[model samples]
Target chain A: MDSTNGSQTLEAQAKAFFDSAPPLQNTHQITQKLDHFIQHSSANGEARRIVCVTSGGTTAPLEQRCVRYVDNFSSGHRGATSTEYFLKAGYAVIFLYRRGSFQPFCRSLPDDPLVECFEPIDELNIQVREAYSEAVKRAIVDHHAAVAGGLLLKLPFNTVFEYLQMLQLIATSMRCLGPCAMFYLAAAVSDFYVPWKDMVEHKIQSGSHILDVQLVQVPKMLSILRKDWAPLAFCVSFKLETDSNILLNKAAAALEKYKMHAVVANELTTRKEHVVFVTSGDNIIVQRDKSHSGNDLENPLIELLSERHAAYIKDSNRQV
Target chain B: MDSTNGSQTLEAQAKAFFDSAPPLQNTHQITQKLDHFIQHSSANGEARRIVCVTSGGTTAPLEQRCVRYVDNFSSGHRGATSTEYFLKAGYAVIFLYRRGSFQPFCRSLPDDPLVECFEPIDELNIQVREAYSEAVKRAIVDHHAAVAGGLLLKLPFNTVFEYLQMLQLIATSMRCLGPCAMFYLAAAVSDFYVPWKDMVEHKIQSGSHILDVQLVQVPKMLSILRKDWAPLAFCVSFKLETDSNILLNKAAAALEKYKMHAVVANELTTRKEHVVFVTSGDNIIVQRDKSHSGNDLENPLIELLSERHAAYIKDSNRQV
Candidate 1:
């Protein structure tokens, strides 16, 4: 295809995607929550920095009435943990997450989190187990405080369609914050999806032992977000790779391509312990502090990003 | 292809699958747990009837390194609920569930499950919220009793490969239980998978704008379970359909083809409220009692199945 034709076709495809896609089920409710939260956070003349942390993996359904889907690998651990850090750093957080992935604060609980962490002391009462009581209490109290103060808003998504649509709504809603708004996208988004019009409405029967599935590229929306949907917002995206050799290079390329403020490059195996921050001109490696056992890489990572975000906001204000 | 050739090829494929598939990571540990639990349960010349409740959905990885996967839709509510009922009915349960799906006692917890159900009373204490204390206590006490008494063996699986291998191990381990053992196949298993030999290694790069994926049918193992793995055990499979018209017919066909003792057929939308149990001689419709708001369909379903299992054991003894 010629360049002009390809560009027009891509633009048309993107438009069709948004037009034909099913509207998010809780759009009205989420819009109300976002409006109220933004107003509340900005009210005191000391506008709280607002950050949207997108977590977990988005699924690309194989059928309209989907029984099967292709999912990216993410437990949402990085996002959830980063959210906690962001909140602790005094930023208002919009936690856009997968419906059933890990949640902040409950990460330290047992595998059978809710049930195993509590015990019946008697017929009249249940109490948190002694071993888990301290951690559980701290998490609950801090989380409660954040929610009550209108500093945290939780929005959940399952499919790639829902995630993308909700993200657009979130971005536009935060536009009023300008450079004070931040997008920390750690969610493993699908790069390709089967269009709704092309998908079958029923469950694919097992009668055919072989199945052929065709998926078209999901139009890259990063450029659009940067150019249109909350253009002045500070954005940080992630690049996860299995190979360490290509990790930093790919992340740097993404930084240049998307004009991202920063890109966090992580290898699959060492992601929990280390990450390389790729900015316009520098690559800085950050590691979990071995001297302190409980210190997470996200603690340092968020601290650095928040500082950079603050500077970005100051610079933008001066420019304006 | 001739029928004979097709059958032979199918047999060869099944054999190759088992031979080439990765071994379960915790095979030795799981085997030891099962052996010890079985011995303890049968210690006093009275053997506890064992039920293996497989919960949640198994995911089929699209690549060898598996950054992406095809996932079956299941929250494991059926399996988790059924496990509790089986436990209450005085049966030992092997809860082989997906890693992150619902657990037996945590079902009643709020959407953000653990963190929402408790509050920090003080610096030193955490208490379950008054509104949820009673239910929480009951769940905890019952779960604790099951684990402490060696009546529950919880094993977790994630990928399709891991799930099948673990299921095989569980079935073979339960062979000694003979007619007293039961298989409750509640897990939503994927019908098709990209075989490991054919799958690409590492993440499927996003460079390919359009992606084509080919998946081969997972060899049906229900027949193998019936014929070899646990010949005398009673088995019940599930058929979850979105269409009401085909649900019962598909369930019945599964029962006949797999030589399953029963098949539970459910429609997606009404699954929480209703299920039809298809057996050799009856199609019994079971519904949640609307009058009793808290009554789960599993309570009656388990009662019926356990009674049938008891009869089967008696008949087996008579035959022996």
Candidate 2:
């Protein structure tokens, strides 16, 4: 197909995906929150650099009522950790995360922190346990400062429908920021889905010994985000593969096809230790500082991205 | 097929399922915990009534690496709430739950209670926010007492593999309790699963526009549990359906086929409001007290179950 036809086909597919999706239950509330947060961040004659960090995994429901779903694998550590680093780097962050995934500033806490980390001093009061006191105090203080200062906005999603729809909403809203906006796409979005219209209204019965399910590929939304949603925004996408051999090649292909500013590639097993940045320039490999016990891979990754974002902003200004 | 032949086939299928499955990562640790908990609960010349309450939903992994999986829908509220009620009824609980699902005592707290419900008083300490103080204190005190008093032993699982394996271990461990043991199987387990041997090792590549997955029926373990694992234990299974028309019939059939003492029939829409206890004697519908806003349906349900269990113990002793 010709380039024009290809673009039109993608546009149509994107439109159909959105049109068929069940409308988000809290669109008005979410939009209002985003508007207020963004407006506040941009107030007082300062245009704070704002980035939307997408995290966790999105589900593909086989049934409309959703008794069962296909879920992508993501603990949401990358996005949550990156959000904290971004905030520390002086950027206002909008964290679009999976509903039950990890949250920024709560990384050090236990899984059941409420029950595991607290003890009742009396009938009317509760105190953090001694072991968790430091971690809990830091988490609450840092998280409070971010939210109270209007530097962080957290919105949660569960399914592919909610994730994509919210992404479009966020991208369009961030378009007003011109070159100041960034998209950190880290969520493990579903590759295939049973479209809403094709889904069964009730839970699929288990009477059949052999259950055959047909899932259609989820339409590629990265291209649409780059071309239409927020063309001027700096977008960073991720490629996670269990096989190390095909990682960089797949990431490079994605970067070229989607026009992402950078594609972060890492083998699933080694993702926590290192990542390769596939960009227009040399492929930069960043690793955790083995010498430092407390160092995180995201710490260096965010520093490099922030530098590139600054350089991109300067170049955009020169062009203007 | 003859009953003996059918039973042999089921036993074979169960064996095959377990043989082909990957071993649980923390088998030794889990087994040790269960052994210790059960031994302690039976100590001091007074055997405590013990209930193994299985909660939450188990995942059916589509790939061996598990980048994608099928998940059953359960917020685990029923099991968690039932655990609390069971503890109140003087039953030691072995709560086998999905890893990240709701916990017994932390239900009233916010989803991200660590960051949302607490505030740092200084660099050294943190306190529960006033709005959450009462809830936090009550939850901590109750949960702490139950756990510290050796009445609640919590173990977590993620996959159907882990859940079934853990259930078997718990059942065999509790067999010594005889009529004092109860199995409250409330978890929404997967009806079908991709066998581990048949699953692909890596993340399923999304190169094709269409993905076809064939899932095999998960062998029924309820029958085995009643007949072999813990023959003297009272088992109460659950039936949840979106179609209320077939709920009672299905629950009755399950109770008969699995030889369950009772089967709880719940329609998805009104599960929290009411549930029908499909027992051999009579089916009784129990509802939350509408007059009392603070009342939970599990309160009356557990009370009724406790009374029936007491009667069952008395009958067993008479037979002995």
TM-scores of the candidates are 0.96, 0.97
Identify the candidate with maximal lDDT.
Answer: 2
Candidate 1 predicts chain B with a TM-score of: 0.95
Tens digits of per-residue lDDT, candidate 1, A267-315, equal 9889999999889868889888889888999999999999899999999
In model 2, state the lDDT of residue B17.
Answer: 85
Show how many residue pairs clash in every candidate, following the order shown: 0, 0
Tens digits of lDDT, candidate 1, B1-320: 12233445656767877776766787798889988888887675787899999999999998777789999989999998999999989999999999878888768777776667776676555667889876677778878778887889899999888888888888988999999999999999988888787887777878776889888888877877888788999999999988888998899888987899999999988998989999999999988878887789999999999999999999999999
lDDT of 2 by residue, A1-320 (tens): 12244887878777778888999888888888988888999985868899999999999998898889999889999999999999999999999999889999888788898888887786556667889877777888888889998999999999999999999999888988999999999999999888789888888987777889999888889999999999999999999999888899999989988899999998988899999989978799999999988699999999999999999999998999
DockQ of each model vs. true complex: 0.58, 0.62
What do the candidate models score in CA lDDT, each in turn? Answer: 0.86, 0.91
**Candidate whose DockQ is highest:** 2
Model 2: residues with Cα > 4 Å off, grouped in runs: A1-5, A121-125, B1-5, B122-125
* Weakest lDDT window of 10 consecutive positions for candidate 2 chain B: B1-10
Candidate 2, residue B227: lDDT: 95
